[model samples]
Target: MERVVSIDRVNNLVKKSDFISRDLSWLKFNHRVLDQARHLDRNIFERLKFMAITASNLDEFFMIRIGSLYNYIDYGKERIDYSGLRELPFRKKLLTEAQDFVRAQNEYFIKRLRPLFAENQFKIAKISDLDEDQKEKVKNYFRKTIFPMLTPMVYDSYHTFPILMNKLLIFGVVTVSQTDKKDQKKLSFIQVPQNLPRFYEIEHNGEILFVPIEEIIREHIAKLFRNIEIQSVNLFRIIRNGDFTLEESDDIEANFLEELKRKLKTRKTGRVVRIEVEETCDRWMLRILKNRWEIDEDNVFRAPEGGMIDLTGLWSIVNHTEFKDRMPDRHPQVPPLSYSEQGETDIYEVLDDRDILLHHPYNSIEPLLELLDRAADDPDVLSIKLTIYRLAKESRVTNALLRAAENGKHISVLFEVKARFDEENNMREARRLQKAGCFVIYGISSFKTHTKLMLIVRQVEEKVTRYVHMSSGNYNEDTARLYTDLGLLTTNEQVCNDVSEFFNAITGHSIPTIYRNLITAPRDMRQQLIELIRKEADNARQGKASGIVIKINSLEDRETIAELYAASQAGVKIKLIIRGICCLRPNRPGLSENIEVGSIVGDFLEHSRIYYFHNDNDPILYSGSADVMVRSFDRRIESLFLVQNSLLKQQVINILRYNLRDNVNAYIMNEDGSYTIKESTGEPPFNIHKEFYEVTLDDIQDAKLF
Candidate 1:
């Protein structure tokens, strides 16, 4: 298979087509997020949040994505990516481009958006502009609130340089004596106390005025050195490597909690990635910083208009009601689901007759919660097992597990503690579950268990029966309200048995191979998908109506992309709805001419992964957590369920059809990674998500009458 899709062949095809680099394409996506910040149609506060999100997203990209590239370059691995093009050496070309982009973004923010912020009555005032009364107010506020937490240090040759924390902004002052003629220059640094608010509000002329803490310190630099003429002031911020490593050692052990604590401490001193300085800084100050920090010119960034060191702090301001625009009318989820539910309704009974699919945010997640709650209290429940990759901070699912344990029902929670940003939260939940007498298993150390599965063993008559809930999203209630995901609840014995063995394999019980209804990763998912694609190719060659449709967040797995390309060559119509990074180059003759891909970026994040294959006269549909990425297919534990029910299969098909037909938010991918927004025609257009939400409401109403 690998020989068939030769690198030379792929490169030749790529050379003849338009294909943008993946990293550059990702930057364009971030630009779209920045565009949202400038969109006048959105609420002002939401736009500010978008701006903050873009900044935070870039920080992570630098820390993880770009940092990984640097490591690859350091290791001398100059191999090309899936796109068959070699990336330039890290820090050699990427650093310059990244810095240039950030400068442009900061310029837009400061010059255009800052004035708009002032018009909204949320002003960031300079300390020198404050009058006597406002200065006194600030002084009193600082003394009463900030002085107790103040820590000041002088940086000189004698004292070791102060360690700057990651992403922390600090004020550097050069205090010199006015009377001292010979040489009078003294440098002092004050670490901005992280505990204090970045913006302090003061009322003047019945309007709210705010001052940045750094600016306040700039104003008071003269007072700190009464005998000297203040030479210059500079504001600087640092970015440090946030990647953490686990090791067996005396100081920091491999225990998750201890390692997390040690990581938090070590993060401050990690390798400095970049440094941002105030634009007005003197050459001497810049030289001292670069020399002392051992930072190269490429690593230094002079902010345009003294941009905010951490734009995330804007969230605090955005949350203020006075400056925010009115929120749009939002339809709640509960009312639709409660058409016949003013009284109690058993979820199992509803699912027993037909498969119930839940599209979250449009549909209430309360049904799933209620199912868990019932299982927790019910004596008929024998056992409950779940795979938890990420959960909400205050998760009711955890609470239900605790209750189930208390009720003497065997409960197990497979907690993947390495769920990226939520590692600490998962660790905390794992500890809580362990302390509550529930069996809590840290997932396989080699691979993250990204599967979303829940199993409930209950007594039906004298026999025990199993029910399962498999979803494309986490059991996180918070994300469910924002991410578009699909959930399936069923009592299929084959699926439940497969899930049981899958969980057992992760929890230290070795299980031999067994045939199952669902496609599970790290074992058979990749091969199964490949086989399906081959079957489709055969059908297409036989002059049958053969095609494949898949919707996922990313499409980069080499084998899968090759298989899809082969299928496309065989005349199988391939439609892909990928929301993020895609390496597949379509529209090239003898390769992927029959393949087409589009993305939908709208109000809610499109996160569900669905796969559909035309099996001659029959169609096979699947919805699950696994994307076609290598991590999903060969590393993580994931599941993709086959839709056996005719109705549910049709419903899934309908969704794919709607998504493919959508033009409002859909962007078609070119042979290059760039996307073109599909233009709508004169007909009343269909917004897929909006239409789905409305249909779900109608379905709920119709189900009530029956």
Candidate 2:
């Protein structure tokens, strides 16, 4: 018999169940990333890459999350968050945590990686540590190259503080005016040149020494202001508010593109949310900056120990050619369709046999690219339609679409113009598609179409066939090499018909009330998920076999969490593999004792979303682009498809099994919402990425012989 909770106990669990703040949970995720930098088991260069990634990740977090919180405080809109933290107190606590995180990151980089780099024949040398010959060379290089690009502006009666662009490093010079006999200090600033490389290499006795451009500029900053006595030159950067919400305007369809462009241009001038300065900066100088920016002490981030304010630039050092051996070898991708001596296998023919599941950074994304290439050239293919959220700078997919249009094939492309950070690139690509005589839709108003779908309508023989490719990641080829994602290719008529209706619903005014195979958001995806979870709970209550497993980037939906809690209380075993924010607190007694949660962070980001439900013996699986966040549930156009093919279902099952078994790269979440890294005692360490890479290689090799 299944254990059941009394009505009173259930009510108490509901009232007491609290969520972790999304912002704080995100920091915990980043900390796991920083833990990679602290781990001695990983390669030195790879560890450096982890530190650099964390730096880049934090930059965006401040610009969006922290910036939004400050806006709330500014407009007297202080309210309690999901975690029951008021806006003011949350900001204070979050700032302290951010400071501690930054301190820990700096300590790890300085104490742990500094000696490792020296032993590996690579060094980040300070200007003071350089020999006289190297110093002279750096001085000359700065005077000739960097000095010409700098423009120093003084802050006084005539000029106000220059509005420094977001995330740009600049020197805040505290100087004594030479014109005044008394020692009077004035403030001046100069932005570091963006075009110059962040790391400058000096070859001494065949040993490579990496030097930061900022140090070179700092040593020569005094020369820029010859008339002033340079008292102190502190390096600093600012993160501005980047939370831009598009308001509904009349005639939005006509001027939406222009308005979006305007917003992008003005985003740089948003309110200053945070300021980062060197720890050695004078107290008075830091105070003046704080007062001018109107930010409190919580917004001030002092990098007392980190070598650089922005470690993202350290990618130049981490990716140097000399240290390639220290980094993990790039696994050779498995081409799904291998050319045989008899003939090249048609990709469509392969899909017709069975649905192919792709695990990225392990299995190559080339097969899907080739599928599009083949569709574009085939005379039988009538039209190509796809929704693009983000794309690489040089996107082969878009280029192929252009070629199809040029070849007299109809092409329809939906470009999401508000995909944060990639808006400009999306706009450029949309315009390029329009120029090629292809039909283009900007996006649905009040919603962003984030589904990864591509449908090709091909007329094979007397019947019309629809080919579909759906994935959990973007179509960007570059990110496919970095992010772990899943994609599916199938010629199933039911799925293709639903995809057809999906495009119509987004591009036109058609409201799809039913789908043959796919579950779509902003329509019924959330309800479908709730119903599925309820079904599992019902099974558990009936004393039938039941279990739930999900792998997603985030889980923040309250309704979903409550349903999972109910299921857990009914004796349903629940497992979650979330890569990022997970507000759901698991393993709470009488609340979620049957639930377990873990996250994996390593070389390849766990970006795929897979949901599995054990329906009495037969299991059902789904893969899609949607996370469990509220934004994805109600405001974004997303899709999740049912995986019914037995072989494909088992492949996804194995994927989850490996991630669950991972002891080295996985972190388990505690009931308090903190994560502890998984450790192997006596048991052999199993890394999911490594295991998947080797298995896929073997599968590809086996296919080659056939």
Candidate 3:
């Protein structure tokens, strides 16, 4: 055996009880998030937000994780889970766990949240629950707005079964046509349009009432099918497989773009992985679906004794303006450690003077956006090159690039058209830039570019300077306020030149011989990272101070996990602050006794990737978008930049220290792959998410600094 990290070897590795299944570990993260929603300590709206977040998370999980499982199971391909189970058994376990989660969520919403709705002046009511005036208004609104958008598709001997859209709330009406003497049951579906509001909101004397669109439709659905006696109206939502690989091609613009568009449609019609139905629905109808869709019994989840509840709709309530004041306030972001509390920053001048490191949500993203905005119109700027993985819908980042292109500055963008769910938006925006005379590459052939890098070439005062911005996140302003990320702004010649070369390699489709300080994936990143860990292990064995701290979104690479285990065995103290999906088992007596794993499910998404190694107390730190996952290391084109600046390095070190100390929002991973929510034991509580937002310079100085 080569001992490589792949599905082929996962069973062998797991048979030794060395790793947790990645999918199971991910579900634990979702459970931790559900715990957050269950917390009565947080305000109701905040809990609702977390509840909605869990729903959103599960949607993607079904689309990607569960969908991938079926890709093997349905195709009759051989596959084994990292947990050592064959595909069939693994799918059973995964779906059972997911079904349990869905049930728990629904029960919580119904028992806990539904009761709170009225006390908080918000009610999830039926038309019968509404007053006469409110009822009339809702009925009229539905008849006028919703009725026009819905079409009932019939299925019988004469009619074909309708194609139901994925993840949409659909009403399955079992009606018997009065015209037919046989009284044959005709199954017809009315899919709620994705664009329509989930609820029809009406205010009655300061009390906000939310009538679920399904309720409104159910009440008047009889109108859609005239002269038919409706037997039962049941609501269900199905998730279709969304995973697909684009055929690699040398010509991406003309070939891959159209292929991607066609594939996107397949998501709506692909194999149904899971079907969620209202509890107490017609069993015959459910059986019909199960047989027709070829979905197993485990795949059909029943709502918690309530009519079909799409918990994702809770987001509407979470973001509703009326309840926002009741939610936890998103405190204003303070200036970065390098920024001064003064007028608008001259980002170029600041970078020219010294490098600036940004910890997002704690530090404003305005400075970065302002950099691009200024570069758009700056006379000195000759070219702007950016690698975009995701963008805000109304992007100031896109606007700046367009302005730069129109201003005759060379605008080159590598829009990753294979960025999962964001492919449509990326393609649409990429074409806009392409039309504006900007040189746009529609991503590399097979590897998805996940690097976040921007290079602005400026010639000022007869001197050419390259200003580089790198980050562990997207260039989206909206997400910057909600995701905890790290970014760097620098004009250091070597670093800038390295970024230039890296950009040239990707855009020019040529591999660079060297990068001064960058470690890129699908190249030597895994090797570099393993070597770094081994170096720490050797140092520890030599009786020198050695430690490793990694903060990332996921940690599932088996090879990397093995190396970390080896380092731990060698007495290298390891602390991992992974936000989600950690397969590495920690605190195992002899295997990983020195390794500590913590997951923070908190105020903002913990999205940054920070790698730190204690080189005999001379710390080495790198931050980038790469997670310690197989996709990040072997499949995606990712890069991690070395942080050599003392202040920046010190600041990131402090970040690891804060996260490790956090009692709130932290879950300690146990040897059994379960998490224990970290709690204060007589000591005052500390939340890293809050500390990063509230701690001042003086407070930070009290901790060890560079």
lDDT of 2 by residue, 634-692 (tens): 99999998887766676777788788889989999998888998878778989877788
Write the residue-wise lDDT of candidate 1 on 1-706 in tens digits. Answer: 0012244554454455434345555665666567667667776667777788878887787766665665554456875654444544324344665776687678877876777765565677887778888889888877677766656566665567778777777777777666655556657777788878888987666566768887776666565555666678788887777765444334411465566567767667866767778778767767877777556777787876647777777776777665545445556664223223512666777656556676676777777888899899999999999999989988999999998999999998888876777887998898888888988877665667899999999997897878888999999999988888888877877777877887788776676487566788888899999999999999999998788999998887878888998899888989999887777887877788998988887667789888988888677788899998888988788889887866566666767777887876688877655567777867577777677765643342322100
lDDT (tens digit, per residue) of candidate 3 on 80-137 = 7768777876776677778888888888888887787777888877888887888889
**What TM-score goes with each of the models?**
0.88, 0.94, 0.95
As for lDDT, the candidate ahead, 2 or 3, is 3
Inter-residue clash pairs, candidate 1? 18-672, 19-672, 176-228, 177-228
Candidate maximizing TM-score: 3
Per-prediction count of colliding residue pairs?
Answer: 4, 0, 0
Sliding window of 10 residues with minimal summed lDDT for model 1:
697-706
Candidate 2's C-alpha runs over 4 A off are: 1-17, 181-183, 249-254, 335-344, 696-706
Model 2 residue 635 lDDT score: 91
Model 1 stretches with alpha carbons more than 4 Å out: 1-22, 73-90, 128-131, 174-188, 203-208, 222-229, 244-265, 288-295, 321-325, 334-344, 683-685, 696-706
- Better by TM-score, candidate 2 or 1: 2
Clash pairs, candidate 3, are none
